[model samples]
Every structure is written in structure tokens, then in C-alpha cells.
Target: MKQILKNSPPTRGIDHLAFVTDDLPATMGFYTKVLQMKLVHVRRVPFEMDRGQPPYDNLRHYFFDMGHDQLLAFFEYPQGLDKQNRDLPGGMQHVAFYVPPEKFDDLIENVKAQNVNVIGPVALGGRFWSAYFYDPNGIRLELATTRLSTPGGIVESVYQSEEEARKELETLFDDPETVDYWLSQMPLKHQ
Candidate 1:
């Protein structure tokens, strides 16, 4: 019987997820104090002409241990860049961190205790549940969890019936054939 993660993603997983921050100290404090992530490293991004660096020399790049061998990193620019609307076309809507089901409730309480307004452990189909909140940088975040009983783990937990998937996908396509084709592309839910 499989416990979980039976099928690894093609890229394994993200090495790090990066974002920009205005205040390095405050961002560090919030992530460490609120989320209990540890500060792992701080680098200085050098100004390289046309190299896609943040247009500055020795700007701060901080990394936090986001667990599972992954890092959550932030780059701090001098005087910083202005905040942009998250709803803008190129903006990130949100990022969700995986939380074990056992820890979900306590984490939510801790977030609220820190005076952060959180939305919910809202049901998001199948066993998916998440509580949404924002960091001090206004980066929308979620603590996501799932209740798993199947041997297939997370994959099995999120598995949907072919018929249900078809019904949901149909709305986005012009014809049933297109829907069917895309449906065939969905990763197989292993037994």
C-alpha cells in the first residue's frame, strides 16, 4: 500500500519560491515570528547590466527555510519598489503552503492570535481545505491541508471521478470533444 507521493512531479518540486519585499526586517520578523520559519541565508544580488537583476548593486536577498527541502526567498530593494495590485494581470494571486492535517487548526489559531485576519479553512473540493491570510508585504498566503485515508495519499485524496471532471471542464470548452481531449491529459489517479 502506498502512503503518499507515489508519483513524483516531473520537476520534483520547487527549489525555492521568491518574492520582493520592501522591509527586510519586518518581513523576516513576520515569517519567523508568525510562521516560525527560520532565516537560512542572506545574499547580495549584484547589479549586472541587463542581467535581469533587480537594477541595484548588493541588494538584499534573504532566504527562509520553508521545509521539504524548499526555500521561500525574498529580495529587498533599496527604497523599495511600490506595491502593485495583486489582481493585475501579471501579479501573483496567492501562494499556499502545505500544512499537515493535524497542524492545520493550531496554525490557524496562532495566525489569528498574531492579529492577522484570516479567511477560512474553506473547503475546496474533495479533501482540500485552506485558510487564507496575508503577510505583512500583502502577499496573499494560504495554509492548505487535506484529510487522507486512501493509500494513494494526496493524489488519491484529490482524485475526481471522470464524469465529474468532464462536467466541470465542459464549461471552459466549446465542444465536448475538446473537453474530452483535455480530460485525457489529466494525471491518472493511481489505485
Candidate 2:
């Protein structure tokens, strides 16, 4: 509602989401062995280049294939940083990865077999359900899947139905017309 800006047309999905990890072996193990993500790339960044990168040239940055060609990356910083609190503004609380429903239970069992405690298959208010756990980096992660079967797959599974969204939005918006306007812009109807 703030601006009538156009959405980016050429862009696709996320390329990567970078996180900080102190232990590369443990992080790599959990991601590769437990979660089954492949380690695709690893390198040291040159400090003089990429001005926004960590100041040290020896910093190790590595990537894991987080499915659909998206990379999940991590940086092993030398020192002098505190553990981040997800409650802080602009911090990530958790990341949820989509799992096909067929693979959901097996993934959860595999995680638990590796001694990771999980807290779901909880209903996320739509067809989507999830199991939450922590990585070696202490990053909360969720493996989510849908109970509803459809060709749209993960995207369709998580999308809110008009009735479900309107019910929640009604409590927040004082104007029904505003909700209707946004709902019109949303692709809530199934194809």
C-alpha cells in the first residue's frame, strides 16, 4: 500500500542465503549428511575486492545446494563477533525448506536418528506442515511439506486460501475494502 512500484520481472527465486558458521566440519556434516544437501562450492574471498565482504582475505565461504539451484552459503569469520539473537530486528529467526510430502517423515526420522531434536509436523494454518530443529550452527530450521496434493507443489501448498487469509486480515485491517483490494492482487484461486 505504500507505493505502486512494479515487481522485478526478470528475477527468479533466491540465489543464496548466507549465514555465519564457526565450525565448517560440523556444519558441512549436518547439511550434507543429515539434510542431504550437496556441497557445491568453497573458496576464500580476496579482502581487497568485494568491499562489503569480510575484511580478512582468509575468510572461507562455502555453498550448499539447497535444492532448485538455490545455494545456502556460510562464512567462517576469524573472530570478534557475538552469537546473533533471532529476536533482534532484521535477524532471521528460522528458515524453512520445502520437502515433498513423500519425503517428510523419512527426513524427520533421519534428523532424529542423528540426535537432533525436532518439534513438528505442526500445522502451519494451511496445507503445509513442518518439523523444526536446530543445525550445528544453532540456526533453527524447518522441513516443511503439504498434506494437500497438487501439481503446483510447494508454492501452492503454502499459499493461503482466500477464506483463511480474509479471516486473519479482517482482524488487522479496519477497512474491508482494503483487504479486498489486496486480495484481488493475490492469486488465491486454484487453477
For each candidate, give its TM-score against the true structure. Answer: 0.86, 0.84
Q: Candidate 2's residue-wise lDDT over 153-189, tens digit each? A: 5554556779977888898898999888777766575
**On residues 1-191, what C-alpha lDDT tens digit does candidate 1 reach at each position?**
22333355578687999888888999999899878899999888778897776777888999999988999999886555679699999999999888888888998898888888999989886778889989988999999898655424655566677877888898898887787777676764543
Scored by lDDT, the top model is 2
Q: Which stretches of candidate 2 lie over 4 Å from their true place?
A: 1-9, 48-50, 161-163, 175-177
lDDT of each: 0.83, 0.83
Best by TM-score: 1
Lowest lDDT sum, 10 consecutive residues, model 2, at 2-11
RMSD to native for every prediction?
5.0, 2.9
Candidate 2 structure lDDT: 0.83
